[model samples]
Target: MTWRPAGVMGVAPSLVVALADHLQKLGAVERVRDPADRRRQILTLTEHGRELLGVCAELARSADAEFAADLTEAESAVLTALLDRLTGR
Candidate 1:
């Protein structure tokens, strides 16, 4: 659905489903049917998924640091502030 973050990321529903299945195979997530709607499946992160999230966070932080390395401290702060405003953060 367009309401999903995956949609914002430009991922097709079929790709999302495939990825969810792969995550299930890796014990990183599980899919459960919605009790109210049998056709709808919800993907919930497992403990492994939480660990993966931690790693993803670290990588994102490192990338951010690297990307901002050329900017002065004040410039970095201003850029961050502007980006936050644009992103409605």
Candidate 2:
């Protein structure tokens, strides 16, 4: 998806801005002015960013699987629900 600032939800705007700045600094993303609207900017991920994202996703999946290894299906569901609630998701 094209990254528009408006598409972000449930995150504080300041935190979003800070993350964008950090990513740009790391060469992971670039803020490009929209051609049709020069006043507007769009955040686009660089190749490096895509690679990093893939790695992070894999790590998360591995960690989640390990974390749930000892839990039964019902226990896993309950744990997921409790975590979601704790995170206000």
Candidate 3:
């Protein structure tokens, strides 16, 4: 898989160390040194991060349902199929 920067939301390469330290203090994530490359580290989400993801998923589902409520079932299905085709999924 290709790796892409998280963009502005990411602590860029220059600020990764400081960002890791901040996340550690907040107990939101952890940085682990890769066994194959001691100089490189990967960030993994902590329990708090998983909980936040669940909350966000619920919110996203609610918003999607609301947005599609006005459409007929067939229309909604067609729209979803079109989106899937566009996304190649």
- Provide the lDDT at 52 for model 1: 91
Model 1 stretches with alpha carbons more than 4 Å out: 1-10
What's the TM-score of every candidate structure? 0.75, 0.69, 0.65
lDDT of 3 by residue, 1-89 (tens): 52534453455765766767787787778878878779777789999978877888999999999999999999999999999997773
14-75, model 2: which lDDT tens digit per residue? 77889889999988898998898897678899999999899999999999999999999999
Candidate 1, 1-89: lDDT as tens digits? 32574666677878877888898998899889989789888889999999998999999999999999999999999999999998872
Q: lDDT rank, highest first?
A: 1, 2, 3
- When sorted by TM-score, best at the front, the candidate numbers are 1, 2, 3
Q: For candidate 1, give the lDDT of residue 55.
A: 93
- Stronger candidate by TM-score (1 vs 2): 1
The Cα error of candidate 1 at residue 65, in Å, is 0.8
